[model samples]
Target: MLVGDHLGRVETEALLEMGRLDGALMYCMGAPESIYAGLALRQTLIGALRQEGHAFTETRFQAWFAGLTTLSDDPSHKARPPRAVCEAILTELTHSAWPVLARTAASLISALLAPHDLQSPDAAVELHTVNAHARAMVDALGAAALTPLPALDALHHAVAQSTVFAAVERAEPALKLVRADMRSDPHQAPRWAVEMLYGSCLQSAGALHHPIPLVGLIRPDTAGDMEPGEARIIRAATLCEIMSTQLAMLAHASRQSKRAGALDTRSTSRAPDVLALLSGFGAMRSAQIERVLKATRLGVRGMVQLLLTAGEIEQTTVSGAHLYAVRTHPSDRLGITAPLEEAFSDDAMDEYDASMAQIDRLLNNAASLQR
Candidate 1:
């Protein structure tokens, strides 16, 4: 299917069709700046759709929502590091910065929802709308940095003294305006941005790729590369991420309780084929893996990431062809011998290989989005 064309075939169409200026676009103090940012994000998305084929930009939203979270450690890992530098991080729903984040995210949502400004930028108002909420959040965060406040009272002081964020009437007039957006990419597509608007203005991510729920579930490829987070917060983010994908699948596929050839790989019956093939069959090419799954190239792009992320899959190239094998073979570990090629039918991928162009495209798209 053509790139964007594939989107219309899935449930995501339900959300894209819903991207209207709903009442969610409130007249907050920071709304204009947010709309400006949202327009920039939309344009960046358009470019990715044109070039990358598919994008799950939500996974790489560290920049847009960076300062909003901090890290903690996972208690289960006995060999865990010190309290200051940990693997785990916080999410929007889980962050104590929620008091400020709620307002800031709402401001961003209002910005994303609007293709234009609700009122003229130059128009006079009671409180001037500058880049207020986020700035307020930052200043407020610093002030409340040392003092511990009660749950309810914290929000009262989360905003700058001059920041005014009150309810906006639906009757307010809006005008379409355009601003120059220098750069836009998939990373700019914040995890929560799509999730917050999902089911209404946006669909679940991964129409042309593996569906990653809007959980902002990201970690470094190696050990030292880190983003801010403590242990416990990161754990919460992880739980939320995978569960988001699973729950979304369940909701969309309530009619078919069992995972099958569904759009989302994690929700599909064939999802296990990647692991099964690598584990049972040993080192093989992507074409061979696809043949075993009996699915199109797209569908076969399944649980490889899940396995690889778990450090269970070993990927390397042989004679310029990519080959995958289960790392730390289970059969060898158990002292049981695994049968060779004879166990399967006559499919020798000796001449066949797979290109990681799709994965490369995703990575490039993600890197660009970080701005």
Candidate 2:
């Protein structure tokens, strides 16, 4: 039972083609609604508080809202909000002598719940009962001179774990969506698509200042599902392109150092090219290094061990494979750094931004539905 079937078949297919079905499903899982509710509640509460002659800056409101919603973390990332932050925000909200804010928050929660369709009349009665309990808790907090943290925490959890929230969560996709940390996983289709798109952008721009049109790659016609081998190949090609660019930068730095007499020509001449390769390519397995340099396994292993002992390189395991990369040093000649952003044409960036806005609108519309 694809959730997209209930939302819109064509829209779901479009998300799937873009390799963003997981993202779309997750978005529909009440995140947009939660964000919208939090923002609207904050605005309403602030207005009520101001009418009561309470003083607070927008910055303070932003901080409090961020703490409450866990938006202080990277909002672009899809991770759940931290419990500690939520608890702290609740503690503050409940303990303060701000009855207006508490009442407004309770009203917003009830209003937000009204849109969700329940299973039956009994379910609807149960939802109303939950809302009544929530309102009672807020009233108690407002009446008290100081509400305890535990009480606030309990109230926060009750609302979060309510039947309405569960219903919304159940509507989202069950697939675990890929994140930035999962970029190294060659099996993830989204990662491959992103890497390929980035590589294409790099090749086209020849520099790294302009914005990359990542949305341009999410075409329904072009973005058919990627096979595992295809993903691997794409990952390799992207890594190779990045390494090649890093090597050029290293060479440029080496030339500069040599001209400045900071680097000895004799010493560099005696240094194996493998050092440059490792420094340029970043973390790589022995087989990968050997293949890239066309060197013997034993020779590469010995070089890697020697570099490890010299503190010029380090090894770490990722996804059950040992990988090696150059270590940072004060005296290191090559100051190679990865290009953080891809350069894109102005027209392409504008188009990408528009496409992203359209996608957001679709996702938001889908999220607002109870069915």
Candidate 3:
């Protein structure tokens, strides 16, 4: 929770020296500049421990791991693993220490590499050393290698998901390109390509805060083209979307339950008020209208159904969010002449132009008097 503690001049110099050497190695390996800084810090700590020649233990490993992660915004607290302490712990690390160090470095690499897609060939190369170190640690630990810390696992999972979500968003532009290609030559757009588009759209919908069921949104044309991978993606997306929607709706309903504890408001009598409100607001969710009307859940549901049946209101879904809006009437003409009339009154405009012209002449004449 605390920010890193200050290291005295001597200790800081030593740490920086180790960091510089490690940074050079990282740069030579073509890793990102940020990763270079992180690796340098890790190397510095490891170098210090190796120099000290202290016996490494699980408890000591955990402590060191926690120290490395102690960075925070608060300036008052010292870094969790004090710089002086780390320097003191510096010694030659033993074979027993390799497993802990490998795991710890893997955790750091995971954090550093979170924003990048691990599937990329370039990313794989960037991570090769970190992965190799982790493997070596596992081998050293033999059959007794400790499981990854829960916090590290959680961080990795979140970053990985976020990367996937970003890819899904970017897929739209590519999909449009594919569509254009398919129009020119149908075979150019394979079944897998279409399925990828659908899957991305589906997953994108599910990633929303209040996701709605996307199964209904799936186009019949695309569904049949889905391969096993695409099918699995769609299935997961559908389930997640439905679950998220249900949870959001249920939470909204629960909040309304307290307000609607006493349904003194009449259903039939208040139906017109609800319709007028919807008309004025343009579009709203059921929970929003319920709160505005102070009506019971059942009452609102019944009235909404009636309005739907009467064709007075219609529902539309946009990006997994349900919205209700009043239907436009066929006879309702748009007022096209109002703006034109306001902007141009023939006589008034002529008079204004003449007055401006007179003012300009008077100003020019007054300039001669001043001279």
Candidate 4:
């Protein structure tokens, strides 16, 4: 079922043996349109090739995989490399490529999916979910590489994270395929394959992310005759790789949320204009403020608390929830200064103010004495 099974074994062995992973990949991609044949020959070819110490180098493997994705065959095209090949390629990248492949794949996949997700929700949701898991796995792997010496547990943890997330994402396309089939003919439903696909996805997710053995998620009823364990393992790995890079983005969001909260505690803590935020929303609940300002619950509460203490905002219970509102609009108070200004009571502030005042008084006293 490979793209070019018509090529004799001599061609296959020669190209694969000569560090021509792309050529071999091309041949595999062009083989007869049969899943079983394509998958079997690919496993044999990849395994035999790798065993000969001609594994696709990290840089080359990534380029080849990225190119194939653009070849854009029918989604159901069975001749293309199975998801397993992608997973193996990722594993190779993580192990041999190190920082380069991990970073490249992470950036590339995110860039590719960003537009697709925006344009299509169904596809985007699945892609994002998979990305989350894959990013987690890759980070875990990358973290392991920094160790004094690479250890099995570290690698295993990394690989496991990758596999689980990959499985989740790969399931997205498979799920779409299944639903399309079921919709076309509910009676002729490819129940077994459909169930197995989802089961496999869930199983990998459980093993990689959660403590659950995901085997229970395996669906026993699909006619597609999918091998649940093997399928789940492969899918999981793919999802893990995509998600690995995304983990950084997730961390970034958390940090931004924290910063927003700090600003809320004291408007002076903010790098951006706090007056703009206050003007935009005259009054808001803590939760709403957090959402609008991208701050965490703690951050919002802290900011509101500071405002309350400074008499800048008054808090009132409304419908069993706390609300914060500006005590005086900045525009209205622009022409007037508050009659009462709270002074800092901290020893540091006191010392600083005292020093400045003493300097001013000395200058005044010197002028008077001279006069």
Q: Write the per-residue lDDT of candidate 3 for residues 1-371, one digit (tens) a residue.
A: 11111112222332232222222222221112222222223434443333223235422332333332222223112111223323221211111122332332333332221122223354334233323443333233323322212221222223223322111222234455466434431111111111211212222222211111122212222233455344433333433343333223222222222222223446545555455544322355565566656677787888777677767678766335456655655422121112111222466445545644654465456445655
Give the TM-score comparing model 2 with the true structure, all chains together.
0.24
Ranking by lDDT: 2, 3, 4, 1
lDDT of 4 by residue, 114-222 (tens): 0121224443343345435544443444443442112212333333343332122122343554664444311111111111122122223221111111111222221
- Candidate 4 ranges with C-alpha deviation above 4 Å: 1-70, 77-119, 141-153, 157-163, 166-371
Clashes of each: 16, 0, 15, 36
lDDT of each: 0.29, 0.35, 0.33, 0.32
The predicted structure with the larger lDDT, 1 or 2, is 2
lDDT of 3 at 157: 29
* Worst-scoring 10-residue span by lDDT in model 1: 80-89
Candidate 1 lDDT over 159-239, as tens digits, reads: 212223221123322333433342222212112222221211111111211111122222212113233223223333343
* Residue 8 of model 1, lDDT score: 23
Q: Each prediction's TM-score against the native? A: 0.19, 0.24, 0.20, 0.19
Which window of 10 residues has the lowest lDDT sum in candidate 3? 185-194
Q: Model 4 scores what on Cα lDDT?
A: 0.32
Model 4, TM vs. native: 0.19
RMSD of each predicted structure: 24.5, 26.3, 30.3, 27.0
Off by over 4 Å in 3: 1-267, 333-371
